[model samples]
Target chain A: MDKKWYWGIIFFTVAVNVIMLQLTTRAYLGREFEMVLPYSIVGVVMAGIAFFTFLQWKKVEYKEDEK
Target chain B: MSECPKSRHANKSKNDMVNLVDNVEQKEDLKFNRRAFLKSAVGASMALGLSTVPFSVRAMMGLTDDEEDRVEIIDLDQLPVGESHKFYYPTEKDQALLVHTVDGDLVAYNSECTHLMCPVFYQKEENKLLCPCHKGSYDVNSGQPIAGPPQRELPLIEIEVVNGKVYAVGRQFRHG
Candidate 1:
């Protein structure tokens, strides 16, 4: 797969994580405990996806494409 | 011939050529590579995600707090309509206000203004809460910021009227 594809997923995760952190903090401040858990869970999942996508990209990036 | 200044790998070439036809270690590609950018993005996502864990932990802890404070503030009749009674609820440190709005609705909130923690007082005439220090204001009924520098609403104190007496049962740090 192209490296840019990995970047796209990673960027999306970064964006989602930003939103999740904001919502989690807001729910925490609001004392709405029920909402915080879901937001945090989503954030963690996105982060994991980003990490795996990065590892895949790493495998591709280190190998010189030119033969 | 002298090595080309552009290529750090120029000396590595078997021939002492001024400009190497090809170099394996391309400095420009190394400096601005997709791998480096993707690594940074992954790191940022990880950091952003992990940062919320603390908040989640704290929120879980906050949920366990009991809702049975049920401290009596004053007699319902003692607080006349369109008047306010100052009280300490749940704890003496949490200064709160129980307002009998002109519309005959009972509402309560922590008197500390959301902006800069200034004390907010009821303005019966204006029918709103006012922070004198910065002129911050909140809607009397909902505790939402209405004007001035305040951006967040005051913490609301949940109250219950039990047989001619008012009791504060719980506090919500944020609400509409």
Candidate 2:
């Protein structure tokens, strides 16, 4: 639990993906085809970060009784 | 007295930090502690990220070529300066306005207000488009929202003058 970095990374991914989704919607509605790809790419990259961070967190949280 | 007979684990003690009122049981803690929170957060992030994929897909589909839709709107001589004419361009359902501004610059825009699809009127005296539904206003030349609840600019209509006739050639959504 000392490594709160896991929480930080997960939360950061959520925040970035939230913004990416909003930008994607606006661009889509405005018919800005050029902007949608970059927003979608950022969203997918943030999702990857979130998945890997969860794996790391699971390892730390479910380790054997090491006391 | 000796330790309570009802106790399941004989070694149970406050110092042991196992299954006490202040301590969570291992199985329950595993199900609803930091692990659960992180799992849910990751799920949300992944769901949100995947949600954007559809928008990208639709954007690519919308990039297809649109047919040329040139339609005669009105005669330039019929619509004098400082006056406005209402017409439909590209489609009959789309209501548009052709404005001959007081400054004599010919401009056109889809009259539907960006806020709520309410039709906006050309205020020739003030040189602005006014939406009665929400008091939204737009610049006659740029179609950008000037005030009120509207946030986006009106869709601009591309008009060309040919032999004293005004024709609507193309339309721009979310124009400046």
lDDT of 2 by residue, B1-176 (tens): 45452355544543223444444475577477666777899999999998999999888887785834999999999999999999987688888999999999999998999889999999978999999999999999999998999888887889999999999998887765
Q: How well does candidate 1 score on lDDT at residue B22?
A: 64
Backbone N/Cα/C clashes per model: 0, 0
Clash list (residue pairs), candidate 2:
none
The true-versus-predicted C-alpha distance at residue A63 of model 2, in Å, is 1.1
lDDT of the structure predicted as candidate 2: 0.86
**lDDT tens readout by residue for model 1, B70-174:** 899999999999999999877878789999999999999989887788889999999999999989899999999999998888988999899999999888777
Residue ranges of candidate 1 with Cα displaced over 4 Å: A65-67, B1-34, B173-176
Candidate 2, A62: how far from true, in Å? 1.2
> Per-model C-alpha lDDT, please?
0.85, 0.86
